[model samples]
Target: MSDPIETAIFEKLAKADPKSVGGKSIEPSDVAKELQPEQWQRMLPKVKAVALGLMRQGKLTITKKGKAVDPNSFKGVIRLRLPTEAETAAALAALPPVVEDDDDFA
Candidate 1:
């Protein structure tokens, strides 16, 4: 099944997209706090992991200083936003194949 957490993160960012009548961007913590109010810190990493996965897929964008960045090699603060149609092509990055496993730490 598709991960609900990933779905929520994607949908939330979509709502903040200009094409969807939104002009603001969201932080990864916004999702963590919303979904795990009592223990958001634990959820933050998971949120980022899924967000990075989405970014790598070219289905999302992770911005730093209002500029698109390579998800595989970005540091410090980041904001989540949707990429423009023109950016979709350039946003796609070559990444190592994902090795599936049942381990939670994978």
Candidate 2:
């Protein structure tokens, strides 16, 4: 079964909002605070996986000025920023058309 909390984090990322997933900006302290202690135990690895998607898309960056930064760190308010027209178009264009599969259940 998929972890609901992890799913929530991914859903937030797929919409381009990192802060919504219990993080401030990719800061460890912020994430630890935003997520509950129990959630945190399950959140770390999940966040790391989703963060990779963000990194691949160039929407998030990793830096090194002192201690290593957590990719899930976020800051400020949680806003769901919609994709721009061009981005939406590109994403839509990349998707395959839906196909019927009679051999399997819906």
Candidate 3:
């Protein structure tokens, strides 16, 4: 099971729309604040870590200055958003097709 805080971060990103930001993206701070206004700052690091993990899984995108960055190494300001439909399709297309092996018959 995933951490509740991490799950919340993913939920927020999934709900955001690019058109809402003039076709840009939403910031991590925005999700944190929405989840915990009183201690949003304290929760930021965890949220960012969760976002980065999601990016690595190809379910999220981290952008700096409107361009995607290495989620594991990015510094300074950044934004988080769900992969676009086309982006998702492209990623899925890039994956090796799954094949069942006889070992699974055990």
Model 1: lDDT of residue 64: 89
TM-score of model number 2:
0.34
List the candidate 2 regions with Cα displacement exceeding 4 Å: 1-25, 66-106
How well does candidate 3 score on lDDT at residue 105?
A: 50
Candidate 3 Cα errors over 4 Å, as ranges: 18-24, 85-106
Write the residue-wise lDDT of candidate 3 on 1-106 in tens digits. Answer: 8777667766665566624332447788887887789999988888888877766666777888887786547899998766766655655665568997767655
Q: Per-model C-alpha lDDT, please? A: 0.77, 0.43, 0.72
Writing each residue's lDDT as its tens digit, candidate 1 over 1-106 gives 9896787786777777747422457899988888899999899889888888877777677888888887768988888877666556665546556788877964
Q: Write the per-residue lDDT of candidate 2 for residues 66-92, one digit (tens) a residue.
A: 222333564332322223444445445
Q: What C-alpha lDDT, on a 0 to 100 scale, does residue 105 get in candidate 1?
A: 67
Winner by TM-score: 1
Q: If both were scored by lDDT, which would come out higher, candidate 1 or candidate 3?
A: 1
Candidates in order: C-alpha RMSD to true structure: 7.3, 9.5, 3.9
RMSD of 3: 3.9
Candidate 1 global lDDT: 0.77
